[model samples]
Target: MSNTRPSLTLTLLQAREAAMAFFRPLLNQHGLTEQQWRIVRILRQQGELESHQLARQACILKPSMTGVLGRLERDGLVRRWKSPQDQRRVYVNLTEKGQQCFVSMSDGMESNYQKIQAQFGEEKLQQLLGLLNELKQVKP
Candidate 1:
């Protein structure tokens, strides 16, 4: 039998879990799921985005983004409107409340990041991020 190699997929997931452990509690305190936080962060960073674009950037499926966006809208954290140029396309943006939420959560998030940075040395963390970005450029 051919020797089996360590699973890169599993290793990536484990690393994700380890990284998320740092932010999960803060997200819980803010009553946000990881997906919800991802959407808001993407919208905040990119300004307005089409629904599909938001889903892509947030790494959420298009179908699931609809539901998550619904909750965010209901909670007054996001606002959605039909695109001016395309009636069928929808755009989403953060509301003032969402901006405030991000601001409130920023310090705690930064603290957690700092703790992680301390644990994995700043240089190593930067190197990992750089490598990950490079990996993302690889074509299937």
Candidate 2:
């Protein structure tokens, strides 16, 4: 057998595509785009955060997050208020509705994760996670 080479990014893209196929549908059912869900989950976990912090944590662009946060606030999923110490700074927090949505999404996510775990099995999943972490740790 001959040794073959594959582009690392191509393999990474393939992995991301396959992963998204499984995760995206679950996200859609909860009335969120993946970016929106990312924001919701982050806010749910972190209590409250400024928009800049949310953008950084979500790995989403500031422009998109501005729109997302606006919609979330308009829909009552989030509330934003000027910080007491700095009126120019705004903080965001999950509303009761947002918390409810996060909880509901969590239940669905648990089942989805279980299904993926059963499909991939533990060993392969661990290996995949390790590989991904290794990639993350590489310096830019």
Candidate 3:
């Protein structure tokens, strides 16, 4: 049989799964799904953002984000309001509870990150992040 080339998409997915394995338990323990965690993380870093902006930054679709935001709101982890300047736009921000959750989990997350970094080597991990960020800017 002829040799086949390695697939970039598959390799990237494998890397993501490997990374997620380290943090999934932490997320599960906190009663958060991956998508919910992403939303919280983004909101913690970015403060208030329009729903569309949150969806874009979190890499979640608007439709999925609607349901995720609803659940987050119901859990008291997030709050949303219609924009005063534009009634059609909805903005989302984390509540104090969400901030506390992030703060509480950040140490463990950082520890897991350090463990992953140690396993991957700091320089290689930095290079991988740089490459991935560069890939984000590339237009199809």
Every candidate's lDDT = 0.95, 0.87, 0.96
Residue pairs with clashing backbones, model 1: none
For candidate 2, lDDT tens digit of each residue in 5-88?
978999888987877777788788777888888889999889899988989999889888889999888888999899889998
State the weakest 10-residue window (summed lDDT) of model 2.
Answer: 105-114
Which candidate should be chosen as best, given lDDT against the real structure?
3
Cα error, residue 93 of model 3, in Å, equals: 0.3
lDDT of 3 by residue, 15-120 (tens): 9999999999999999999999999999999999999999999999999999999999999999999978889999999999999999999999999999999999
Q: Root-mean-square deviation of each candidate, in angstroms?
A: 0.9, 2.8, 1.2
Any runs in candidate 2 off by more than 4 Å, and if so which? 1-5
Residue 3 miss distance in model 2 (angstroms):
11
| Alpha carbon deviation, residue 109, candidate 1 (Å) | 0.5
Residue 125 lDDT in candidate 3: 96
Q: For each candidate, what TM-score against the reference? A: 0.97, 0.85, 0.95
Better of 1 and 3 by TM-score: 1
- RMSD (CA, angstroms), candidate 1: 0.9
Model 2 residue-pair collision total: 0
